[model samples]
Target chain A: MEFTTSQVIEILGTIAFAISGSFSAIQRRLDPFGVLIIAFVTSIGGGTVRDLLLGDTPVKWMRDVNYCLLILVTSLLTIVLKRHRKRFTVTLFLFDSMGLGLFTILGIQKGIAFGLSPGICIALGTITGCFGGVIRDTLLNTIPLIFKKEIYATACILGGILYFTLLFFNLKADVAKVLVIGFIFALRVVVVRYKLSLPRFGY
Target chain B: MEFTTSQVIEILGTIAFAISGSFSAIQRRLDPFGVLIIAFVTSIGGGTVRDLLLGDTPVKWMRDVNYCLLILVTSLLTIVLKRHRKRFTVTLFLFDSMGLGLFTILGIQKGIAFGLSPGICIALGTITGCFGGVIRDTLLNTIPLIFKKEIYATACILGGILYFTLLFFNLKADVAKVLVIGFIFALRVVVVRYKLSLPRFGY
Candidate 1:
């Protein structure tokens, strides 16, 4: 019963998004069912979109009920832990960024498997990293952060480029994967920490 | 130079959604580029989602460049017709409802092709009918009308049920398809005209 590295990353990412979505839903004062639905969507949304684009049918979650159970449990735990609401924002951000990093790499790998071009793979990675949050925010009736803030997708794109570059330099696959994930997570944290944002056009 | 019934319905649905999307974007004060983008998503978003769920690779627009061109033309035409602003809302509703009916039948056909259960086919039909508008409204930062108002999806669902019933009664396939589409379009118009709405839970 050994889980491959990709499997591990996927599980971790799922949990991270589940936590992120649950916190956001609870913050919005959604009912428990609504919170759970948000958690479920945030956990599986990106991968589902990625699979759909690649024509991978039955979608991952539809075939694997375990992922659904995992989200249910994780969301319930997050709800039960709401007494520690002081750290809500930080917790949600951290988990979301972590999920973004992990899911981006997974999407890139899937694209590579499908023989998609490098640029398309990077686009897929960015989509996989950002779409879950986009769906979550959209369902919550807010402008998606991806459209409002550029750095979110930027980090994933940069991480994708770094992955390809590392592989070009003959870096071990596992090492490059870990490095790219850490790079994305750290980049997002630094950008937010420094209050960095792209200039917007006044419409 | 010959076209099948399905192809005609698909084209009509695409054009209808493109108009619906462009009008929505223009009303939201988006620029030309933004309007076109919204129109593209509204025209293809549901089919893309349905294909992904069914693992249909390359999706429709990706494989057929003609659809893209059609959407582009349709969107531009919609923008040009913008000066008829007084009738915008009514025009949008008419095209949207027509697209919903057309796309719903197409989706149900696809589901049957895949040998999916009737229930699942109906679900797919509803998704195909409604998701483009859902995506368009979400991108525009509005609560998707499907969630806020029940009749949107309800019309699709009822039409799906009607299609199966018609078939069960040995109605010709072509006749049933046309009837279902007209039924959905009329049902939605009547629902909105009468201001009928499902009661909401005050949670």
Candidate 2:
């Protein structure tokens, strides 16, 4: 089957998320099976959630064997390169950010296709972008980064808004998609580099 | 809208799970919003997952305002009864078991309706019965009880198998449902009372 550019980006995002999850599992000293499970959940959890909520099931991963193979291969690679854990930490951050940006746009596009309103679409986009990490953190017994002041979901929301705005003005679909993904990726990079965060509750 | 006995049982299960979630939130010293979120998630999380996996869109809760109202009232009641926490702990356990049994059967029934095989239906039943508490525990920053030595998911699986077995013998649907639910509820009660648990891996 011929793959589109969007499909290629989605595959890259899945690999990135899978690597991040594997790293978390290794750091937590989980067993091999645990590591694989974490990797699979982290890579596809968000998309699975979005599909399910949209009433699209058997889920995308179950429908496509390629996703499973990707996650499995990524997990194996991470496990094999455990000796270079320090080097991979940097890779993890980059992959995670890229995955977040790509998944957010994919989710927004899906919601729009489903004829949902802008606000709900934005919410779906945020959930799609950030929920994998949320599940990863939760399984590792930590507060989810998105629930903290990370500005993670914030970036997805902003990107989703930009997506709708561009479409409203009749921008080319490809241009809008690229710009939204770029915006989200850049925002995440800048926020982490500057150590910026939203204000937390005082009490 | 005439409601069937099965529907009533499902609503009761929802209320029970909501109360359990509210209790967990209050114990963890979560804010009011956190408490409400936990309650809502615990009450509907499993069924939402099942529906999503079944391609049943807008989710049952979105389609039914009564589920929301039920969870809201249950949360409020849990908060009001917080002063009687000691007494309510017992109530929480009872409700939790009841919810497990009802939800398990309901999930199995839905899977059968979808024409899935028995094994897949059993797995779906276990997920539907247990995932709410799993979500609640994860959000509260704890390992899920079902993943541990707890006989929770085991009970659901056993009950699901029994449900199919009864149907295979040409038993009535209502009778099968009731017997399966009773078996699960009883198993839970006995296991907890006897402090029984499955063996864990030494590694």
Candidate 3:
């Protein structure tokens, strides 16, 4: 089957998410199967939730074997790089941030395609972006990153808003997708680099 | 508004499911918020998932605040009954099992109303019966019961199929619902009491 450019980007986003999940599992000293399970759920759980919500038939994963392959390669890499845990951490975080940005845009676009309101679309995008990480943390018995990381979900919400704003001004779809992705990626990187965060409730 | 007898039965099912979730949360030693979250998810998650899949407008909780209140009271009772945990556990489980039976029937009825085929209806019903616990477990940071519990999902599947069979036999909707619920409840109880289980793989 012929693939669209957007589909190609989505596959990349999923792979990035899978790698992030793999690293999370590795950090917790999970065995390979546990690691694989975490990675698979992290990569697909959000999309599955979204599809089920949208009443989309045959969730995206079931429709395509490539997604399975993407996670497979992602898990294998983490297994091979297990010994270089420290060095892998930085790269994995970058990939995860990238995945978060891309996935959020994909989710918003897809929600809009199904004729959802902008509010709902952005909410869905936030879920799409951060839910995988949330599942990953839950599986590892930890508080989810969205709760702790502060900017994680916030970035998706911002990017999703930006995505439609650009579209409203009559920008092309590809341009809007790219702008939203870049905006989220930059915000996440800056927040991490400067140790910026939303204030905690007690604070 | 005139409440149907079936609506009354559904409220009972909801209460039963909520209490079951609360007891499980206590068993897992969750905090107050945790207990509330568990009870709410357990009681409504299955049906919510079913409605979303059917593309129904306005999810169930949005329609009625009573369901949310039911879960809250159930959680409170769970806390007060802490000293009688075992007895309450039994109560919760019995009701929880009953909730699944009723929910499976509910899902099949909705699917049939939507004009879906028997296979889809049965599949939808199984999803409705079992997935709430899956969501509850995922939230509570455990492997889902569906993966570990013997015959949990299979019972739902069998019961859903039987529901359609009764339909084919020209049974009235109400009669078919009761019969299927009985079948599921009996099968589930027998399996749990007798420790009967399906093989882990290749059913």
Instruction: State in Å the error of residue A171, model 3.
Output: 3.3
- Per-candidate TM equals 0.60, 0.61, 0.57
Ranked candidates, highest TM-score first: 2, 1, 3
* Best-matching candidate per lDDT: 1
Q: Looking at candidate 1, what is the lDDT of residue A167?
A: 96
Superior by lDDT: candidate 2 or candidate 3: 2
Better of 1 and 3 by DockQ: 1
Docking class of 2: incorrect
Which lDDT values do the candidates have, in the order given? 0.88, 0.84, 0.79
lDDT of 3 by residue, A13-83 (tens): 89888888888777766545556667888898788778877878556664465677789788888677566
Worst 10 residues of 1 chain B by lDDT: B28-37
Candidate 1 per-residue lDDT, tens place, A61-169, comes to: 9999999999999999999877878888898899999999999999999888877767668867887998899899989987676654437877887899999999999
**How accurate locally is residue A27 in candidate 1, as Cα lDDT from 0 to 100?**
90
- Docking quality (DockQ) of candidate 3: 0.07
State the lDDT at B190 in candidate 2: 94
List model 3 lDDT by residue over B1-203, tens digit each. 88875786678778777877887788888889989889999989998877776667588888999888877887798678668656865765587789889888777777777777676677678778877777887777666666554567677878987877888889997888888888998998898888877432110
lDDT of 2 by residue, B70-139 (tens): 8988898878766765665566677788889999988998998899999999999998999898888877
